[model samples]
Target: MSAATARATIQAYYDAFNAGNAAGMLDRVTEDIEHRVNEGAIRHGRALFAEFCSHMGVSYREELRDMVIFVSEDGTRGAAEFVVHGEYLQTDPGLPEARGQRYVLPAGAFFDLKGDRISRVTTFYNLNDWIAQVST
Candidate 1:
């Protein structure tokens, strides 16, 4: 894939995410996609990704900051970096819950591409930051 295509695919993935459609996002990823979270190990397959999204539930809002894209020299993979701000609207036991008003937390993600879609995703952020904000 060309740099332009890689960048486009990265943007499209986020578009699907912002649309609150995990399946839609998964549709654009490769079948054996490997997703890694900063807090854990590898999460394989689109199905596992969907289960994660379901566990997290719907977000009331997300603020993406200085989002940038980087395509690998091989042209078969790409990565993205950005500060993601999210409001807790739904509930997830694995994650924190806001009891009043809302909260804004920073998040980030890095996805690898295979042809026209992402085949791997590595995410990074401070889970402790989220815990500190909601633990109260």
Candidate 2:
């Protein structure tokens, strides 16, 4: 894949995310995709990814804003920086109680690409910032 194609793939993934289309997002990833959640465990495969998406669908509603994507010249790596504008819809285990609390947090994801699909996705954000925002 060319850098341009990788960038477009990342853009399309985020587009699917903002659209709340889990299947669309999955379609951009490899069958054995690796998902590294911020401050959480690394999950493998598309099925696990789908499970995570399902849980998140119930716990939060989010839109990625101001996204900017960068891809390596080799097109094997990519990253995106964005702000998450989100509402906490339900309480997630080991997290704060949710009564529709809303938050805006800066986040980013690093991707490892294979061909045209994402082989790995590792995401990051300020957990403390998120806690403070939703705690109040």
Candidate 3:
């Protein structure tokens, strides 16, 4: 696939997430997905991804906007830029306060894709900003 195509596909995955549909996001990825947030938090397989989604239920209710895609030269990889808007699910990990305050966080990700499946994903976002959003 072209870099642009890969980027578009990745963006669509987030679109599905924004809709609060974990199954939808899974549809865009390979059965064996690699999701990594830096080094310590690396998740593999679709099942794990789904479990992770469960945790997100408290914090994310399909709120994402301003999706932008950035592609590599060869199309083997790409990145996305967007903003997440939601109520602060303070109890959730990597997020903010539980009292449900309005929050916004800038997010980005790098993807290693094969065919239509995303084989690997390295996500980036500001934890501090997330805290600000969740904290009342």
Q: Global lDDT of each model?
A: 0.74, 0.96, 0.77
**What is the number of residue pairs that collide in model 1?**
0
lDDT of 1 by residue, 1-136 (tens): 8778888888888877777777777788898989898878688987888877776555445556677778877657777777766666765557666564354566667767778888888888887877676666
Q: Write the per-residue lDDT of candidate 2 for residues 10-40, one digit (tens) a residue.
A: 9999999999999889999999999998999
Sort order, lDDT high to low? 2, 3, 1
- Backbone atom clashes (below 3 Å) for every candidate: 0, 0, 4
Which one wins on TM-score? 2
lDDT of 2 at 20: 95
Per-residue lDDT for 1-136 in model 3, tens only?
8877787778778878877877888888887889888434789998888888777775555477898888887778888888877775546644343775776788878898888778888888887676655665
Give per-model TM-scores. Answer: 0.82, 0.98, 0.85
Candidate 1: segments with Cα more than 4 A from true spot: 58-63, 94-97
Model 1 is weakest, by summed lDDT over 10 consecutive residues, at 97-106
TM-score rank, highest first? 2, 3, 1
The RMSD of every model to the true structure, in order and in angstroms, is 2.4, 0.6, 2.3
Model 2, residue 19: displacement in angstroms? 0.4
Runs in model 3 with CA error above 4 Å?
38-40, 93-97
* lDDT, model 3, position 126: 82
